[model samples]
Target: MLPPSVFESAFNSSPIGKYLLSPTPEALILAVNDAFLKACSRRREDLLGKSLFVAFPADPDDPASSTNEAELRASFARVLETGTPDLLPVQRYPIPLEGPDGTIAFEERFWSAYSAPVFGPDGAVTCISHTTKDVTEQIRSERALRESENRFRALTTAGQVVYRMNADWTELRELDGRGFLRDTDSPRSFWLQDYIPDDEQARVHAAVGEAIRTGRVFELEHRVRRIDGSDGWALSRAVPICDAHGRVVEWIGAASDITERKAAEEKLRESDRRKDEFLAMLAHELRNPIAPISAAAALLQRMQLDEALVRRTSQIIARQVGHMTALIDDLLDVSRVTRGLVELERVPLDLRDVLQDAVEQVAPLVQARRHTLALELPSQATIVVGDKKRLVQVVANLLNNAAKYTPEGGCLAVRAGAQDGGACVEVSDNGIGMAPELTGRVFDLFAQAERSADRSLGGLGLGLALVKSLVELHGGTVGCESAGLGQGSRFLACLPCLSGDTAPQGEQDDEPMAQAPAALRVLVVDDNVDAAVMLAMLLEASGHEVLVEHGARAALARAHEARPQVFLLDIGLPEMDGKELARRLRAEPATRDALLVAVTGYGQDSDREQIMAAGFDHHLVKPVDMERLEAILAGAA
Candidate 1:
């Protein structure tokens, strides 16, 4: 055992604060060492004979001080009653200090305390020994760490793809993708290869190198491999995290899924490109017919020629005009069909008869090409419910394509029969076939194979598109197959077959209507001077008194004066259009009963509706069908 003097020396020189208090309920302070006096900022004489509570009074303003005081007193009481040591918890215990101005202020502090009972000779507790150590700096450091961890959690929980990378970006330390990407929890050296697509990895590598060299933020819109192994897009950004010496330690990054937005942008770009191509093609097509027509007209006006030569020149003009008109008609037809404006006239009919009509329409083209045509039809009648005219049109278009694309002396076959519970019409040709890429989208609008500079195989690429649309409108399907270029191609159309009923008998052809022989007064109005005069001349050739007017106002005045029985008015006129003229003519007593007809270039359904609503009795698209117009005039006569 140590001597009494040595034990007292150790207690007084100890770094921890130590004190002794009487073991009574009053708990009066009996002694204090040098460390205790220094810690409390008090002298030994000031505390010795005073109660422990009086020496360390609780601060009313500091709530933690009150708690610390209660805990210390409880610990001391327990040591006295149990005659054992009691370890106190770490707590905030504020101390009062005198400032330079003699004002007392409380300094915030944290401490860990302990108390033990001291036994006397009689084996009874004489006093309690207390020790305290300051722990303020450690407590404050722990609190700051907790707050940092909470902020990190909040960021990861949001819909952001947070990631951490090594200083040079050569390694991926961690990643929380939040479902937008694949998560990485461990360091990876092959992270770039695993996350980025093969074609896009080089670009990512270049970006990473630049960001590392410059110590700048990295930003890129790039492709990524999704969790399901599908291709996706992301807008990624990473900023350099620096150390105290201004050296980059790592990268903190986030990414957003931009897959849907990128797809929409690509679609818009493709649409714009296609529209520009279509406009250029339209200009080329229009100029082709215009060149020949202009040349023919100049030859007729500038030269003296024989009757035969003059007739030949006129035929050239008429043929080129017909070709131009056909091109316009195809454009309008496709537009109407795609917009769901065409209505089918569905009727039960024999498929054989429909095929026969289609064959007749394409017979001229086939003979000119010197192609051998073969027809394979079923023995019995194949009945189907469809529009006979549209069905004929569909077959004719397919057969025409075969004739146009096949070389001279090629063979073409049209086969029709009942197959797969439906009526199938197959058109096959031993001709130049399509490439693999072209076959897939051949039915799309304006999609076509490569054509020569002269465009010898003349077409606007609307035939197959129209065939597909019309077949689908009849609740059927159409498909094409080819064995590469120069082999062969086949087109198949399938339509639902009519069952459990006999085919309806074909309707008899209508007799030709009788012509009106008596001369009738007629008025023709048009914005073009040539169109008005030519129409007037045609009327006079039929023994009718004809008046020509160049505008709507002139036509209305002429009709009122002539009291004409027939009126052919153009829809597009200067200052006043044909529909308004028709309405104004209908209001006048002199021309109210006239057979009003519309002659215009506009032929859409909406245009037709407007014409009819303006009181016109007949609507005709230009160049007017002379036979139909004659019929209308004959009915009026």
Candidate 2:
């Protein structure tokens, strides 16, 4: 027989409530801690020896009962009758209990219960042990975990590959089978001894070992081999599990199979590097036009109004701005293409107009290089409806390509004539022609025929490829035909034509020069030897006598001999800057009457104000335009 003392001792100290039920299930003997009393809304004496059915009855008339009283009785009855354990799915039963307010509150509570039969020596059922646990939060957490896993799986599977690594780093089990990857590591190890590349294994091993030892999560990317014997890429991370004693037991981690992603990242990085190169090219290309445009703007600002000259200057501004916009747009367009989102604007435009505009754009280079350019156009108008800008780009690319490959004295011929139901434009140049192998890959992105560090040509290989893509976008095809090495090359563009109106005449007429300013002894000062020489040449061309000085100190010494009426000083001069030089020149009695102009590449409004405030009479930015410069000289005289 079980000792009564043992039951009493358990009754006093137990956390869960225990009750001795009477035959009628009315009043009951309560054995519980304060939590149980609170759960049932009762005291010890009120629950003692009362029939269990009467004291804690299911509401006879109410459909909703307090504690699964009927279910509990049924479970208890089964345990008593059969002495067997009954398993149940999780169920919720309200406590039929309330706080001091008699209202349902946070602790008004529900319990998920389990009952077992405790047997005596004769195998008769002695008492039932009932256990209740609050599972509200646990259930919620489990559901959230499942939903989150589903969501994470969805995102990773859509584009990037996701994998789950086992506790040991030995296996990289696939989570998704996208099969899009770039494998750089050897593919023979089933992704172990050879999955990570030789150069990367040491680093991978270190990170993984550190993570496991410290029980910390680990993350990294490494070259991995794929199943196909081709190398690829993978990014992985791991989480550690700890025992109750705070010792690490196991780890669960996720990996993303990133073969294509790796390739794309490498490509993007290359693109960024190319953009940096382009910006450098742009800086150089920009200088070519900026000197003239800014000079023109400054000259236009000061000159008296005449419609013809004003129109000419305005056209110059529009053209230069358009060039800058086009270059910037090239960068944007490449970005769009790589991101898989390039749109086309289709419109009917005369192919002749595009060719003419492109020719005119390169006219300055033609004259500068002393190259003879011949244009052959069909008398019959050639009309092709497509994107006008892209058409212009195609023609301009041909011209640029010609200029780069041809010698200074080479001939560049542009022809635009009607072909078999299509418009054809061809550009041919003579210089050092392409080698057969080079010609085959001329249109490859970033392809360069000559990439020796000291090669003379300067291009990133985007121009022709961009031209090709743009032309193709407009329903046109472009091709290049070149004789072997030393033989010149010709680019042919063919666009399907629609019988339409004649092409408009682009601006091909030249504006009359701004007449020469009265001659004056001028002094030009700059630290950059090339810039000062170029300025002096331009000034001399404008009919002014010019003297050069390398620095502010040199300018001060040369001022006495030059007896100059005007001085152009560079702001970024070595030792002393233009501002100080201008001030020092003004202090000299001989130069007091001389007009001081600060010439520099700094065009910010604030930079101008600072120069003007520092005793310079005028500020000029570099790449000086001849007309504006002439006006500056005229105003000073």
Candidate 3:
């Protein structure tokens, strides 16, 4: 038996827990700290210095008891020889035994068992020092905490936004796909690995140096790595997270996907530039008609009363005004087509009927030029789903082109029938045919075929292009063909046919359009004298009492004299545009009740809204028409 002081020394050296030991031959003896022994039903005097098999006893017949007895004896002998402890698989178990008071008191305990050999002063094996550590709840808690951390890490790394950073941007630490603490060969890394070109690496390195110097943010946009492994533009912003002493610690950043936004902005800018070019071309085009119309109107306005000459010059002014209106309408159509904002009113339209109306409208022009128009439309209806008014415009443009391009006595043929399982229409003219190269670009905006040097060809190239857009919008296509220059040109249109052919009544069934009251006193104002008079003349012929002014000051002077019911003012003037002039006019009681109308080439929808808000009641695009003018005057609103 060990002395009390020696036992105290061993107990103090060891933590407060249960322990196990084996005697030299074969015996199960356990040593426990006072803290552990207090929970036992066995008396302290009985526990110490007693045979451990008596203190904490087990059944000799049980498998656990016999197996543990053999293992303890074997391990003790081996530790004595080798001077090392041995671990056992069974970490926890209860030793069933008797207690003090000579009563059968059950002792229930959990422990981690350990066995090491003890030596005497002669260095001979005396016993195996053994221990049992009570740690039933601690191991379970650590395992649960480890599991929770692993799950959280997995969730974070799975997201695209989460990333690990190196103190320097030179290298990156990759995150697993699940964000867990495991790695694969293809882990998620930073964008620096790609995107930057080989030549541009030096530049980026210099930029990194600057960022490190000032500890400021690095802002840049460049083509960078994408998740798909392809390259795209990235808007990257990185900022240095500094230490307490103001030294740079680490840099962190976010890269946003800006590829689509950049592309869309470029497209919008291109569209705006095209519009500016078109407007400039429009101004140049309007000058052509304004000059001739102004010259003719000025000559007629100065003439005295000769009924024959008066009538003849009036016809010239009228013809020129019509030509100008056609051109202006074409420009408006181009804007509408380019923006993809044209809405179609789908009514069942018969192609033959539309072609006939177009043919009749061009009959007078064809007659004067002595060009023969041949019609080859099928008698039956060639049904289509379309807007009737737009269809009329399309056919009118084709027929007009046929008549205008064909020389006097040349044949212009129109054929509408079924072809290629769809409704096909062909317009052919025996005129100076176009070159192959010209045919390719014929439908481009502002494109025109060069005629003889006199340059008398009237139409802009906007019509065919507009028609092509309109046709495609309705799921149709159009193309032009020619047998080389000077032979002829043929234009064919193929439109999808309507479902089952029971059609509605023709447009003659809806002919009675609105008719307002008679024309009111209307004022026409412009910077150009001829434009103002010709507009005035057009309205006058349409049955309104018309007044004309050359400029804004003159217009303000005449506003009271005319007591106009409506003012058609141009926006471009020397002193001010018609919009500002209209504001001043609206302030005057003389023209207070009069409806102000703006007539300018700046006819974009947004521009029109601006003029209207500036006190104008109506807006008209430049180059007037007699019929539309009559409609406006009659309504006078």
Tell me how candidate 1 scores on lDDT: 0.81
Best candidate (score: TM-score): 1
Error of 2 at 8 (Å): 84
| Superposition-based RMSD of candidate 1 using all C-alpha atoms, in angstroms | 34.9
Sliding window of 10 residues with minimal summed lDDT for model 2: 181-190
- How many clashing residue pairs, candidate 3? 6
* Best-fitting candidate, scored by lDDT: 1
Residue-by-residue lDDT tens digits, candidate 1, 1-637: 8799998898899988888888876789887888778777677756889988776677878777777888887888789778899998887888777653346788877889889889999999988988888787678656643443333322223344677888988777556655433446567674677778999999999998999999999999898776567777777889999999999999998766666556867977966775666566667777888998999888888756889989898889888888889889999999877756677878888888889999999999999999999999889889889889889999999999888888999999999999999999999999988888777777887664243235567667788889999999899999889998887789999999997376655765543365764788888889899999988887798888998889777777777677989889998899788888888988998888888999989898767877899999888898877777777777887
Model 2 residue-pair collision total: 20
lDDT of 2 by residue, 310-364 (tens): 8888789768866765555555555444333445556667676788889988888
lDDT of 1 at 249: 98
Better of 1 and 3 by TM-score: 1
- Rank the models by TM-score, top first: 1, 3, 2
| Candidate 2 Cα outliers beyond 4 Å, as residue runs | 1-215, 226-232, 244-249, 258-264, 275-379, 384-397, 407-422, 428-452, 458-637
